[model samples]
Target: MATAGNISFIPLTFILSGIPELGNNQNWFAFPLGALYVIALVGNVTILFLINREDSLHQPMYFLLSMLAFTDIGVSLTTLPTMLSIFWFNYTQIYLQSCLTQMYFLHTFAAMESGVLVAMAVDRLIAICDPLRYAAILTNSVIAKMGLLILLRGLCVVFPVPFLTRRFPFCKTHMLVHSYCLHQDVIRLACADTTVNSIYGLVAVLLTKGIDSLFIIISYGMIFRAVLRIKANEARLKAFSTCISHICAVLVFYVPLIGLSVVHRFGKHASALLPVFMADIYLLVPPVINPVIYSIKTKQIRAKVIKLFRRREIGARDNVIATI
Candidate 1:
C-alpha cells in the first residue's frame, strides 16, 4: 500500500508562510490546497478583524471566540496547505525532523483549542451564575492571562511529542499513510523503540484534551444547575438564549474532534477519509458558523452587525447619488 501523504521537501520554507511544505519536491498541489488554505485564512482574518474593530465585541465571550478564530488561522496555516499538497499531488517526501515539528504544532494547537473551549465555558458559567461580579472576575487583563496560560500549558503538553520522537532513528520507509502530520503516523515511521513516545502521546491526550474536557463539562453542569434554579421566567429564557450559541459551538468542536480521535485510535483499519473528514469539519465548521451562532443568539451582536451593514449600504447610496 502506498502512503498518500507528502513529506515536506523544503523544510525551512514553512517558516516563511507558517505553512510547512508537504513535499518540496511536489508543487503540483499548490492550486487546490492553496485555495482552501486561502479561504480559511481569509475567513479567520475577517473574524479577527471584526472582533478587534467592534467595541461591543470586547467581552469575555467574544474575546475567547476571537482567540479560537486566531487559533484556527494558526492550525489551518500550519497544516492544510501541506496536507492538500500531499493528498492532491501524492508528494511523499519529508525529512524526519520536519515531520516531527509538524506533529508538535498540530497537537499543540489541538490542545490549545480544547483549553480555550474550557475557558469559554468557565466564562459563561461565571456570567450566568454571578452577574454582579462578572465584570470584576473576567476583566480584559484576566482574559489575556487565561489565553496566555492556555497557550503555555498546551505547548508544554505537545512539545514533548517531537522532542521524544526526534530522539529515535526513523526507518528507511519514511512514508506516512494519512493526509496530515499526525504524531502516531510520524513516530510509527521511526525504527527505534517508540513505546515511550506512544505512551507520552497518550498521556498528552488524557491530560490536555481529556482533563480539559472534564473541566468544561463540570463548568457547564454547574451552569445548568444555576440556570434551573433561576426564578424569573423571562430572565431564565434570556439566559438559555445566551447559552444556545455556546452550546452549539461546544458540540460542533467536541463532537467531531472526539469522534476523529476515537475512530483514528481504535479503528485504525477504518478508511482514512473518516478521520480526515471529521478533522475538516472540526477545523472549518466552528469558525464559519460561530459568528452566525452568536449573531442569532446574542441580541447586542445582532444589532451591532445590522448597524454596520446598514452604514455600508447608506455610504454606497450616497456615493451613487454623488455620481448622478
Candidate 2:
C-alpha cells in the first residue's frame, strides 16, 4: 500500500473477483468466454474488411458500420487480456494504473459505439425520408467528420474518469466485482466520499448514451412517420426492412445496458450473479451478434459475405486439383 496521507494507504493493485460464486469453477468459463472474444474479433474484422473491399458498400451507412465494427473490436480487445488472465490463470490482481487505463478505454469505446449507432440512425432517417438528397447530405467528407467528432467526443468524455478514480484513496477491499475494471465498480471501492464520482458518472452516461438513445428514438420515429406516408405497402415494407439490422443492433446494445444499469442501481439484494451476468451480456453480446445480424438482415452485406466465402472455397478446390 502506498501512503497517500499520514492516516490513509492506497493499495497498489486491485483484485478482480471473476464470479466469486463460481470459485474454482471459474476456469470452466474460460473456454466459452475466450471463444466469444474470438468470434467478436473475427466477426467485426470481417465486417470492416467487407465494407472496405466492396465498392458498393462505400455508402454512408456502411461507413458508419465500419466505424461500429472498429469500436466493437476495441471493446473486445480492451477487455480480453485482463478478463482471460483472471479466468484462465486465476491472475486476478490488476495494478492500480492498469485498472484505471482499462476502465478508460472500455468506457470510451462504449461511448463511441453509442455515437456510431446515432450516426447510423441518422443515415437511415435520411435514406428513408429524403432519398433524393441522401447522397448529397452524407458525403464521404461529411461521414469522415462525423467519425472524427464521435471519436473526439468519446475521448473527451472518458478522459476524466480515470483521473477521478485515481484521486480517490481506495481503503476498502480492493476486490472488484467483475473480471475487468469498470468506473462504477472502481469508484465503489474508494474510501473517500464518492458523491462527486457518482454524479459525474451519471452525467457522463446521460451525456453520451442517454442523448444518443434519444436521438435514435426520435430519428426512428420520424422514419416511421415518413414510411407511413408512402402510399404503397411494398414501399413502406422496403423502407422498414432497411432498418431491421440497425434496430437489432440497438436492441442488443441497449437492452443489456439498461438491464445492467437496473441491476447496479436496484438489484442490490438480488442474486450476486445477476449483476455479473448482466455486465457480461452488456459487454459481450453486441460485438458478437451485430455482425451476424447485419450479415443476415442486410442484403448487400449478406451477398458480399457469401461471395467471399464462395471465392475462398473455389480457390481451395483449385489448389487441391493442382496438387493432385
Candidate 3:
C-alpha cells in the first residue's frame, strides 16, 4: 500500500470477473470463449499464410489485409491467457502491472485494426476512383510505411494511458467487470480525480475509431460517386462488388464497438451481463469473423482455401491406401 496526496492505495491488484453474474455456471462460459479464441487464432493465421503464399494476393488490398490479420491476432492473444485462467481455473486476480500491460496491448491493437480498416478503404477508393494511379499510390514501399505508421500512431496515442492511470491512487475496489482489462473499467478504481483520464479516453476513442470510421464512410461515398459515372451498369456493379468484404469487415468491427460504447455510457441501468456480453462480442467477433467473411466473399481466396483443404484430404487418403 502507498499513500499519495493524502490518498491511500492498497492491494495493487485487480480481480477480473468473468461473467460473474452467471455464478458457478461460469465454467460453462469457457466453452464458447475457448471456441472464439481458437477460431480467431486459426482464422487470422490462415489469412496471413494465404496472403503470403498466393502470388495473386500481392496487391495493396491484400497487404492491408495481412496487417489487419496480424492486429486481430494481437487483440485476441493479448487477453486469451488471463481470460482462460479466469474462466476455467478460477484465477481472477491480476497484478497492477499485468492489468495495465493487457490493457495497452488490447487497446493498441484495436486502434491499429481501426487504422488498417481506414487504409483498406483508401485502397478501395483509389482502385475504384483512380485505377491508373493505384499502383503508383500504394506501392510496396508505401504499404510498408502505412503499416508502420498505423502501428506507431497507435503506440504514441495509447502509450500515455497506463502512465496516466498509474499516477492516481487506486483506493477503491479493484474488481474489473469483464474478463479483460479496459481503460474505462480500470480507471474508476482510482481515488484521485479521473477527469483527465476520462477526457483523454474520450479523445483517443474519437481520434482513432471515430475519425477512422468517418474517413471510411467518406471514402465509400467518393467511391460510389465515381462508380455512378460509369456508363455500363456491369462495370459499376463490379466496382461496387469489390467493396463488399471491406464493408462487412467495417460493420463487424465498428457496430459492436459503437454499441458497446453506447451501452456503457447510457445503459448503466441495463443488465450486468448485457455489457459484458457486448464487450465479449466486440473483442472476439471481428478477428474470428473477418477472415471467414473475406474467404467467402473473395473468389480467389475461397478457391485457394478449398484447394489447400483438398490437398490435405488427398494426402490423408493416400496414407490410408498405402497402409492397406
Candidate 4:
C-alpha cells in the first residue's frame, strides 16, 4: 500500500473483529457485554455522585477515588461503543485515525488508573503509617497537583503513538484481533520496520503501568509493616481494613492486564476466544468490580447507596398513593 517515497492515503480504515468462533452467535454476546457496560456506567457514576454529595468524604483518599472513577468511565467509553457495534450490529469498520484515537484514550485512561491506584496506596500508607502527618502532607493543593500530574503524564506520553503509526505502512492484512484498538494489537500489523514502535510501546508500559505497580507494591509493603507494629490486634485489623477496597481494585486492573499480555506474547496457539476474553476482562471487569468492592467494603458508600435506593422507592410509593 506504499506509493512513491512510501507515501500513502491519509486515513486507511480497517475491519475490527469479534470472536470468529461464535460466528452468527456474536449478537447473543451483546446482552452480557451491554450489561457489563451498564453496570460499569451506573457504578462509577454512583461513586462520583457519592463523593460529590458527601462533605465528610472530602479527603485525599476520596479525591483519588473520584479520579479513579473518572478514569474508569473513560476506560469503559473508549471501548464500549465499538464493542457494541461489532457485537450487536456487526459494524466492524474503523478508520485508521479513529482507531488511533481510540488507542490513545484507552491507553491513556489505563495509565491514569494505574497512577490513581498508586496515589491511593500512598494515601493509605500515610493514613496508616503516619496518621498525624497525613493531613499536613496530603493537603488539598498537593492532591490537586497530583491529579494534574497524572493527567499530564498520561496524555503526554501516549500522544505520539498515533503519529508514529502514521509514519509506518500497513501493507499487510488490516484485520485486528480484538474489538478495541490497542497499541500493541495494532502496531504488529504494520508493514514497515516496527522496531521503534515496539521499543516505545515497551518503554511506555514500563514507565506508566510498570512503575505505578511497583510503587503500589512498595506502599502496601510499608502499610502492612506499620499495621503490624500496632500494639493491639483490633487496631491492626481496623487499619488493614481500609486498604481492602484499593487492593481489590489493583488486582482487578492488573490481573487481567497481565493475562492479556501473556496471551498476546505466548499463547498464540491458544484458543482464539482466550485472548478475546482476556481483553474483555482487562477492559470491562475492573470498572464494574471496583465500585462494587468499594460499596460493599466501605461503610460510607454502602450507606449512601442504600439511602439513594430507599429514597427512590419511597418516592415511587408516594406517587402511587397520590394517583389513587
Best by lDDT: 2
lDDT values for all models: 0.72, 0.92, 0.90, 0.90
Clashing pairs in 3: none
TM-score of every model versus the real structure: 0.81, 0.97, 0.96, 0.96
lDDT of 1 by residue, 217-304 (tens): 8988998889889899898888877778778878887898788778767977876556666666766566566666766776776776
Where does model 3 exceed 4 Å of error? 2-10
> Candidate 1 — what's its lDDT?
0.72
Encode model 3's per-residue lDDT on 200-274: one tens digit a residue.
999999989989999999999999999999999999999999999999999999999988898888998999888
Candidate 4 structure quality by residue, lDDT tens digits, 83-153: 99999999998988899899999999999999999899999999999899999999999999999999999
* Top candidate when judged by TM-score against the true structure: 2
> What pairs collide in candidate 1?
6-91, 7-22, 7-93, 9-24
Question: How well does candidate 3 match the true structure, expressed as C-alpha RMSD?
Answer: 1.8
Q: What's the count of clashing pairs in each model shown?
A: 4, 0, 0, 0
Q: Model 1 reaches what TM-score against the true structure?
A: 0.81
User: Between candidates 2 and 4, which one is better according to TM-score?
Assistant: 2
Worst 10 residues of 1 by lDDT: 9-18
Tell me how candidate 2 scores on lDDT.
Answer: 0.92
| Alpha-carbon RMSD to native, per candidate | 5.9, 1.6, 1.8, 2.0
Clashing pairs in 4: none
User: Once superposed on the true structure, which residue ranges of model 1 sit more than 4 Å away at CA?
Assistant: 1-39, 87-92, 309-324
